[model samples]
Target: MLVSNKLLVDNDCPMCKAYGACFTRFNLVDNNTISPYQKTNEAFVNDIDLDRAKNEIALHDTQTHQTLYGLDALIKITTHKSQLFKAIAEFMYPFLFRLYKLISFNRKVIYPSANTAVGRDCTPDFNLKYRLVYIILVALFTGVVLHEYSVSIYSFFGWESSWFLEIVVCVGQIIWQYVAVKAFRKKNNEALEYLGNMSTVSLIGGLLLSPVLIIQSFVVLPVLVLVGYFFVVVSLMLLEHIRRCKLKKFPTLLSASWVLYRMGVLVFILTIFI
Candidate 1:
């Protein structure tokens, strides 16, 4: 349900202008009657407390007069997507709405609007240094796995399988990766750091597992490993670009793309084992 800015003209302010620009850019304005009260002919201007409007944006349900503010307003907007966003809004709305209200109220006293920066300002050196440790660890694990695979080829075929050792190495790698990520998060490394860590982990894992080519004899395994490695490298390069470009805030598009790439890696790994 797209709401039009024209419907709420009586209360138009700078906030409204910003919201209008965002809606227009997203092509979400489907109707000329944008205000929640416009179609219903309700006197929202008179009914709603002006004091509340000073601190919060209001969106009233036409049928119920139910007021939504902050994150509630965001969830309502996301509902129109009716796909991924909709599902996320549905699942996250209840908790997020309360959190938004709590933060919004506290922000009025603790952090004024004038002090808040529009976007994040994180340095490339800071991000790279933060992630370098994780990258080195992943590289080390990759080297070890590759070495193991190379040695396994010459060990009497089927006489003594190294499958148990492979499983142990995989589990150990996973544990180390998890610990590295946990530490990174605790340190509040920027999105670039997160992306770098993800890419390094995926690439290292894929390269190490490439020796699967010798034992599996499946044409798909090598292709999967190569594709995974390519994505990891590309993702890391894009993250580096994000820092250099000083693009819009942290959590850049590259970070999201890395997540999808990691998901693909997970699926490939599952397919290989199962």
Candidate 2:
């Protein structure tokens, strides 16, 4: 179900570029037509509302010269593959549209966009509601994963893991980072953005550990194996933190503070709990 459509995606956003590639890869649209709005010609760009396209993706119909935005564009492209999906999409439009907005609003914060000097920068407007929703959702997810992982290792420490404690710690990390950023950087506006990036790192670390948590549910794995895997995930997270910090142009001390917070937590756990 190939459509004669061109998707103008935010080139600076990796996720947007990836999906654009996917549409072509899966034959939902033509390979050559998936153009970056940043690099798209001025004449072609005039086909759609530029402001709306920045907030939501723009899909241009080559033949009809019609443009659709956000979930409408995606549903149109994807539903072409199957009638069942089309029916489901039609039924679930409201929920799916909200979900799409959530992701679209937070996409830049999820992965900060690269510098775009050549053309239109398709950065979505910062909506505090969406930002907080993103942060709270990731915090909850990370907290739950931490609570489960902590319980798995509780036998070694002779302590029980509390969901409340883990959730508090999850929140505390955000607060701690926010305080540190404010204290050092002194930029109130950038703090939220920095916290968003930090939360993303936490989310990635939690996601990495989720498989081990799942495996533990089925089999009784050794404590050393669990700890080893956790260390590996932490190491990967460290690399990610460094990469993100570089992307954000944040100081090395912020990364240092990140490590310091975990180390402090480790010390607190070993001394008091164990």
Candidate 3:
């Protein structure tokens, strides 16, 4: 619901401005109520309550008789297109309302504003240089893996038969990847963290199955292979989650390079046994 006032308004609210920009780009202006209201019978708009509007922006859903104010209004405004925003609104709106109430209750202590800017500085400094270095290294490793894969595919002698050695190599690779991911996450690199967590779990599973693959050979190998394949699938799911999270950038090419190295090590072990 939108209430329009026929008063010249200063574009002050950052959240409202950002949402308005998004709405403009989306061409979703029909439902919106902009200020300096013209005398028209638009279903979305009603006469503005100056006192209520002065406190915060108000939105009323006529169908539901649901009214939203302040942050709720902002969230409701964003809820039309973005599912992520809707989820956030549903989960966080109550919490925000409570916080606002608490702050309003303790205005002096919480916000000692002497008619000046009274907000926490929440600027993001994305240290892209360090991230670039990390990306480059990962890319180099990926290149090595692709090269190795091409070489191995062309040469039948490159195939590995020793499942134990393959598992061991996989475990080692996973551990290294995990360490890299932890480091990245420490710097708030969520994309690396997701990949690292997935790889760590997969490697741990592979490590557990390594000894079993060695001892039981024919009996355990098939079962472990199936289990290992399941881990791979889960890892892929985690990767998809990471993608959806939109952690600034995509995972580096070197993210799966360890797998190629493990493949090479497995091939060498198989050759020795043959």
Best by lDDT: 2
* Alpha-carbon deviation at 228 in model 2, angstroms: 1.6
Per-model TM-score versus the true fold: 0.30, 0.93, 0.26
lDDT score, residue 119, model 3?
A: 31
The TM-score of predicted model 1 comes to 0.30
Q: Give the deviation of candidate 1 from the true structure as CA RMSD.
A: 13.7
Model 3 per-residue lDDT tens digits across residues 80-162: 67788799778886887655443322222111222222332222223334333333333344333333322323244454433
Best by TM-score: 2
Cα lDDT tens digits, model 1, 56-142, are: 455555546566655656666656767888788778878776655543332222111222222221111242432444444454565
lDDT of 2 at 147: 87
TM-score of 2: 0.93
* C-alpha lDDT values of all predictions: 0.46, 0.84, 0.43
Which is better, 2 or 3, measured by TM-score?
2
Colliding residue pairs in candidate 1:
4-34
Per-residue lDDT tens digits for candidate 2, residues 57-84, read 9888877889999999899888987999
